[model samples]
Target: MFVIVGLGNPGKQYAGTRHNVGFDVIDYLSEKHNIPVNKVKFKGLIGEGFISNKKVLLVKPQTYMNLSGHSVLEIQNFYKLNPEQLIVIYDDIDVDLGKLRIRSKGSAGTHNGMRSIIYEIQSDQFPRVRIGIGKPQKGDLSNHVLSRFGKEDQEEMAITIGNAASAIETVVTEGVNAAMNKFNG
Candidate 1:
């Protein structure tokens, strides 16, 4: 079994924001697979189905973005799964818009949600597919992340989120190395 977690704040206001890119990506994946996120479990809204012939649990942390680790740890503990079996999808501020980065393992950089997950889980050994939302040109980062994307960013965000979804699917079926080679480069 493999677990895929998408981090984001819960609420209508944060729906299409850059920080919710992870949620969007997982939504796309779930929609494509016809898996509805109907169950509230493990501190998250879970959609269960098979991705690439592997049992997959698509988790959208309802605990919101910053406290994402609470939901993740619950799922992690319940499944007795290792860190390597987890794939986290989240937004990145460094990479260019419309770009996707598939990493085997790395520090959270500036993402508070990921930082919290790392702090709670006590490891950064999990695979992650980062959907780039780009850096802010003005205003605070928190504002930028919480705010919706501009017209220019909308198209790019759509494309990047789709790519991120595919990259995660690749990880589910092919293992971290294959996903890294196919998506990272």
Candidate 2:
């Protein structure tokens, strides 16, 4: 089984924020694959279903962004899941808006969620899909991520999220390298 985790803060206040882009991508995947990610467990929401003949456990950490590792570790231990079987999706401020970057393993950069996951998992060797959210011109990043997207951002984010979700499907079926080539254009 594979644990597909989307990192983000939970609550209505954070619903449409850029930080929730991971959740957005997962929602797209759930809809496309007919999986209902409504089951709550391991301090997150999860849905179990088959995709590409692989039993996937879709997870959205409810412990918020900073403490994301708590839930990830819990799920990992309970399922006896390894880092290789975990695919984390989240927003990236470094990349330009609407662009996505996939990596097998790398530094957390400035992302707290990724940092926390790496700390608890004891390894950064895991697949991740980063949806670019873009940085703000000024002020705190936390405020920026929690803010709603502008009109232009909304338009681009739709296509970005949909494509990212498809790319995730590709990863499960066609492998990471192939999906990267197909999606990272």
Candidate 3:
């Protein structure tokens, strides 16, 4: 069994923002696999189904970005799964917009949501797929992340999110190394 977590702030206001791209990927996977992520538990909205013939739990942490680890820890403990059985999806400002980076393990860097997860879980040995949001031209990092994409970026993001969803499926079926080889450019 595996747990796939997407970190994002909950509520309509945060929807479609760069920070919510994780949630976007979760929604894409849910729709693609016909899973309903309507269950409220583990401090998140969860759905269960098979991906690549592996039983998997799809999660969207509802505790907002900074407090995401609290929710993830609960789910991880409840499922009795190891760190390696987990996969996280979130945005990264360090990479260029529309790019994706897959890593078997790494530090959270500037992402508070990922920092929370690593702090609460006490390990960094989990796989993660980071969708790049690019750095802000202006210094207001919060506003940049919380704001929705412009018309042109929105069009490009569709492709990035689709690739992210495919990457998750690859990880489940082919393992992290193969997925990284295929998807990490």
Give the best candidate by lDDT. 3
Give one digit per residue, the lDDT tens place, for model 2 in 165-184.
88888788877887789888
What is the Å distance of residue 127 in model 3 from its true position? 0.1
How close is every model to the real structure, measured as TM-score?
0.96, 0.97, 0.98
What lDDT score belongs to each candidate, Candidate 1 first?
Answer: 0.87, 0.90, 0.94
lDDT of 1 by residue, 1-185 (tens): 88999989898989998889888988998899988887999988999998867899999999988899999989888999899989999988887777888888999998889998998888999999988787888989898778888897788777777778888888888787887888775
Ranking by TM-score: 3, 2, 1
lDDT tens per residue, model 3, 1-185: 87999989999999999999999999999999998999999989999999968999999999999999999999888888899999999999998999999999999999999999999999999999999998999889999999899998998999999999999999999899988998888
Q: After superposition, which runs of candidate 1 have C-alpha atoms over 4 Å from their true positions? A: none
Between candidates 1 and 2, the lDDT winner: 2
Cα error, residue 57 of model 1, in Å, equals 0.3
Worst 10 residues of 1 by lDDT: 152-161
Superposition error at 116 for model 1 (Å) = 1.2
Off by over 4 Å in 3: none
The lDDT, on a scale of 0 to 1, for candidate 2 is: 0.90
